[model samples]
Target: MEKLKPKLFSVMKNYSKEQFLKDVIAGVIVAIIALPLSIALAIASGVNPERGLYTAIIAGFIISFFGGSRVQIGGPTAAFVIIIYGIVAEFGIDGLIIATIMAGIMMVLLGLFRLGSLIKYIPYTITTGFTAGIAVGIFTGQIKDFMGIEMGAMPAEFVGKISAYSAHISSFNMTTLLIGILALTIMILWPKVNKTIPGSLIAIIATTLIVKFAALNVNTIGSMYGTLSAQFPTFAFPKTNFQMISKLIAPAFTIAILASIESLLSCVVSDGMIGSKHRSNIELVAQGLGNIFSGLFGGIPATGAIARTAANVKNGGRTPIAGMVHALTLLLILLLCMPLAALIPMPALAAILIVVAYNMSGWRECLSLVKKSPKSDLIVFFTTFLMTVFFDLVIAIEAGMVLAALLFMKRMAEVTNVEGWKYIDEDEEDSNDSDSISLKKVPKNTLVYEINGPMFFGAADKFMEIVSDISKDVVIIRMRSVPAMDVSALHSLWNVLRICQKHHIVLIFAHVNEHPMAMLQRSKFDVEVGLENFCPTIDAALERAATIKPYKK
Candidate 1:
């Protein structure tokens, strides 16, 4: 069994001063990159700017300290913006907190059971589709601040938001639009000038200074969310009841699934960069604990931020110490520099999120898949994407998974076949093979049935149909091509056994594969059928059939 140990412990055994210095440099650089983006993500999530800092500080520290990946920077990420906004809008902040805590508990259970690898079963099409949809959601949500549109609180639904934006098209402020454009331009152009300093940070600083000195008439974080909190996060338990838990269950599960996917994906990406392996279950447990603490401290839901994690790696971070230092840096900023964060223009923050959305959209990948992937995959991708954009994200995920499963079952069923062997062709290349059914002579009043492919619920009904036609004095079932069995398929065989008993016919099984044989043994189907009736080959089964006397009805 694999041990549940954090990567930090292993890395610490070989820690050195030179590596510590590099980690510190990388950690501080990542913190600088996370600062403005965290604030932007929180505001986009319809929360105060400080909550982002709180999450980045509290959750970030916990995840790194206990995480399986050396440089996974966990905090408020763009992926959760749509879901978090929806939860906050419908269930209130308390509901969001409760849901996050519930999600945390669920994550811990998933890790403890060592089921983290199960997340890979979620189809890539679905993840790509929803990620693109989330990018769109983030872009749409920022339009109000990005263009300074005069509207009451933004609507939660995509259609409602579109309708409201259209209604308020005439109220967009020119000054705010120009500031947003300026910030966007800076974010786009600054990276070429200085790669070491993030373009988003530079854009924020430039736009905030411009807005402040020029006394521009535009919406700013300070104007909207009021003074930024300069205090450390304080913890408090949320008041909850059964009614709230029941109401929030679906969203909580959604949060857990999303967090698991994003964090593990980030881990996989970072592992490639660092040439290291990550313990997925350990990472999940750390993420759960991080979210639990973040929520208690009045922070929004958080997961691994891919961009920040990448930034850490590119900056020479090679251990968990860097991630921990990154969190501490954010804490120091939260305590001293938070007040300055309020002066940042809303348009600048929107500009930052716009860039984030574009990076995460994966448009090129989506287009390539559309051109080359199978029709079923394309259908799943489009369905998930459209549903996410127009309906609820939870609905999109549920519908996508269900659709994918049904399509998969259909394909499996199509491949599974059951047939009776009439006569083997003498001209066939392998007809003379020793194990060939052609060499065996069937006894009078005997029938041979061959089942091909896996025996699963999807293909069980066809096998049952073959069972219903069993009227021979002696029956032989050939399952050499079968590799596995499900309960439904096993139950169908039981029906065949019952029919043979009622008709007073001799029953035998030939070439029972390992998986099916084990299932038969476990179900005690083998005992009821008699061990002597089970044959290893067609020759043996034919001989056994010939020796057995047919029972009189």
Candidate 2:
């Protein structure tokens, strides 16, 4: 087992003042980048703006202190916006807290069990689909604030949101729309002028100052959520009941899975940047603890934010210290400067999220898959995407996984085959390959059959159907091409053995692979068929078959 140690311990042995300065600079830069994002993501998740800061200060610190990645920056991310919003709308803030904590526990268990590698088994198409779907959801959710549409309460469902938007289309405020456009323009163009400072931060500052001085009739965070709290969140226990747990369990699992995927993905990106490998299991454990503490402090769920992690790496963040510094910096901002966040125009935050949605959409990858990928992959992609858009993420993942599994089985079944050889003329036999049965003499009243691919449940019936009608005095079964066998295929082989015995025919086996051979030995099928009948090669099987006398009909 890989040691369940945090990366910080390893990096601190050679720590120096020079590197500390670099880490601090990187940390502060990343914190600057995270400030606007955390607030925007929290508001988008249907929570108070301060809760986002709490998540950043609490969860971000916990993840960095104990994480496996040297430069992982954890906090609230756009990926959680749709799911968090849905949870808050359905079950309230307390329920969201419970779900997040439950998810944290689940993640810790996953890491302890060393199941972090299993996350990679989730198909790429499914990930791509849901990411795009989430992007669409985020974009859709931001429309009201972006357009400054006056509506009672936005619906949680996609169709409901669309209906609500259409109903309130006439309430669009021009002043708010202009402020949003100004922010969007800044977000797009500011990066070109200055690469070190984040455009989103500039957009927020500029738009907020303009809105405040110009007295624009636009919605601000202060107008909606009131004065932003500068104090740290007080720890509190969330109220939970058996019924609420039952209702929220699915959502909780969804959050855990999403966190696992996103955090590991961020770690992988950081590893590539710095040429280091992350201990995935321990990283998962840290993420679990982060979310657990975040929820305890009345914060939303969080994970390793990919954009923030990359920014840390690019800005000379080389160790976990950088991540810890980033968290502490956010804490300072939350304490002394949080009140200034009140002046931030809602449209500016919406614009920042719109950019986030666009970046995360992976439209090019989706388009490439549609144009070039296999039909089965395309099906999984479209199914997941459509379901996520029309229904919810949990349903989308369930359907996509089930559909992908069925399609995979179908493909496997197609690959597995049972075939009989056709002997060439004696004059042309010299050209045949060494393994070719034509190179070996086949006795009269004997047949040779070969099984190809894995012998699993998907192809078990086909194996039985092909061998059931055999009328030979002796049968040579070749399985060199078989890599594996399952119980269903073993049962089919047992049936074949029974049929051979009933017909008074001899059976011989040839070239069974390691896995199938082990299964056969375990099942005592080798004993029933006679161990001498199992040969290591086609030639050996033929010799054994030749020694057997033809049974009389």
Candidate 3:
């Protein structure tokens, strides 16, 4: 389909040798930066380290090869850590794969239906709330490794996790704590030292060497999860039934929604940086294919990683070739150096996730919203945040959306108003000298009621109450300001038309906007009220009213 055309094709048409070289260099640098992040995210997601690498190599390649954005690098990101962990914890790795595949299918359908732009309708407050909540969860989950606390399996719930950590406070390993703090310190300070090199990678290398040479008793990846697979990922299908499918549908939708939002948001950010527009539907399709392949290859869900995409852009990666090269570089590392990943210290990985949690929290934005946004918006924000922290993300999003819809309806109702035009005597005003003035006097036995704002269901009741109170031989409804109307509003108008007809009164409409006019015509309200009753202006309606004979009592 034309909608599925990848940006890579257009970029390659004008590709240059200099740009190619720059892309190659940037891609390699991004791959290096992504290496430690992928492994760390996988561990945080409660999966084997190799799964993350497989996602980077497989999904990363597929996305870049077919994605709409020029320099968006796709891979495992911090956003999915909470959802993936929950899936894996409840249903095991197989459930996670199946859910990811289902989410991929959903995404494909969304793209095919051209619903990419609709993702923007999701409220900013909800995203901010859930994102901050997830950050808190990730940070809390890392406490065990960060402090080297000796504890059994941590509880999945937020409060339970905190209680578990507190119970194990006496078992903290000072050596592990020192390593974590040191890794976190390096990450914070490394940007100032060299902007090009990633501090996470540096921390991994430095800490791993220190533990290996000194023979420290600290836990490493190998000690915890065993050595990672060096071979390429193989296709593996998951077994499922109707019951499992039904149970996974909600989580799958959650994943699909989240992937759509994150990838599109990344594309928007990339567009601003490169001064280019990205095809959102095409990107959604690419993300779907990427996740599908990633799941098939025993990997986790993947999307456009914002930080990595920014890295590509900042390093002069202006084409999809850079993203492709990034995937290839990661693939090479997976095939050649995956075994060495086992030597990476757990605390170092934990520290990296802590930094990730901190950056992803968006605390400044959250605080700003709390202080400046409207009370209704703050209610949605806090409700989503608390629900996400206490319950599941699915519940949090569902509740947030419902609350937002209700608040939106209330606000719309406040904006929509209906009032009858008051008769002003021509003699009371300093006489109008304008000969071009239309409708010199109000027509006798005629009432003009002005309807303002959109006539949706929320304001339909008020509209009906106002119009029902008008008693005249002819009623002219002025709707120039009404841009649109829903079915409820149309039904209310139909009721008014019937009441007017019952009383032998003529009903007319004046200056209706395009959308409302179309709706009225579609519903055949114009025919029921007589086509002649629809006027182009208030003056025209007044002229029509004067022609109509008075009703006989």
Candidate 4:
């Protein structure tokens, strides 16, 4: 419950006028940076330009107001572009809104249950694979706009989209192509000249003015989507049926998972940059609330944008106020200048998204992983990457997790071993005292075996085989090195105890750790084995075994 506290409250306790001024300046700067990006991302997601602005204004404000990280700036990021586009294509706007709302509910439940940290368990290889796959998807999707190819609605799948672009290759507009290339060039070069103003905004303003004044025959947002409207979004519930809800469940889950991952990752990055810790659960709840509102307001899904967050931090924003100010700034633009945004050239937006795709791809990380990671990890990476590109994100994530889990279990099983303990010479034992646990001479008629690593279902069979084959008056199981035991392993141990009872062989557990001990107690195995038979160390177990009356046939 403590994790539910918003970071804004803490920052406001000592808020100063100087800090407020700094936050305002940083917020305004981030808003300027976000303006063009919002429009580009909206258009990229197969929605009108103003929906992006609405998301920035509505979702951004909610997240900043209730978020866990002080410096996080929330909005529609490049990561959501592919998934959002697919949802819209398959289910239409109403279905997309329904899925988003359902996803928001899932996110809220995850946060309330304190399951935010669980998202960290999503494998790095899977994230890398999907991220790279998404980058390629985004870049591929923009090919039509970037090349000024006149095509109708593009296909949702990567292959179909590519084929369509190829078929329409001859329809490429040179004017549109030149404008896109120039915009890309300006974005690349603008940082060298100035760092304060965003290059994308400059590109948009410049390209829009050129096309408008020159009367260049090129497609703009207005030409494609119609005149921009300044109407504020009204609360509207999506009309849905049971069939639609059932169909949307998978995609909604995907959205929730991705949103949780991206938002938490941003929080972690912001924490590192600011020397602060963020409550992951609170951040998740904030993201969930943001999405709920965003859907109600006819906007796409939103999450903390890492690039915008970094910009806020770099510009001296040390509190949530900066994020709030940024949202307000976007709102101002939406209310006053949204019509002007319609005049922006589509090619420039395409160029901006292309750069975004490149950055989000994380190709360097992918290359590094392929070069140095284990073969099993590489397999997971490629499987996820290819699946995401050719199939669907939901399938890719499911398959990747299953494969990763199986491989992890195989590795664990391979590492788990049961071996007989042997005596070491005194001089050798002394030299290796810290590294190895030395054993004294075993008591007569006693068989001792040591179990190493976790005793999970995968390793249970081997444990049972070794113990069941022991033919001795007394059996001592050493478990000092066993870190944990699962139910399957416990059942296996129970079988061993039953076998010992049937054979009239005394069984003793030596140096069992807390987890195994608790399990044994809860299962009443300790009582069945006789509490005295469980010893604190191997030596004590040996002594107990020696004192046991000889088993008679």
Q: Write the per-residue lDDT of candidate 3 for residues 12-56, one digit (tens) a residue.
A: 998999999999999999999999999999999999999998899
RMSD of 1: 1.8
TM-scores, each model vs. reference = 0.96, 0.97, 0.96, 0.97
Q: Which regions in candidate 3 have their CA more than 4 angstroms from the true location? A: 1-3, 427-440, 468-470
Alpha-carbon lDDT, every model: 0.91, 0.92, 0.90, 0.90
**lDDT per residue (tens digit) for residues 323-355 in model 2:** 899999999998899888999999999999999
Tell me each candidate's RMSD, in Å, in order.
1.8, 1.4, 2.3, 1.6
Model 1 error, position 345 (Å): 0.5
**Maximum-TM-score candidate:** 2
lDDT of 2 at 101: 98
Write model 4 residue lDDT over 92-199, tens digit each, in one string. 999889988888889988988999989989999999999999898999999899889988999989999989988999999999999999899999999999998889
For model 3, where is the 10-residue window of minimal lDDT? 430-439
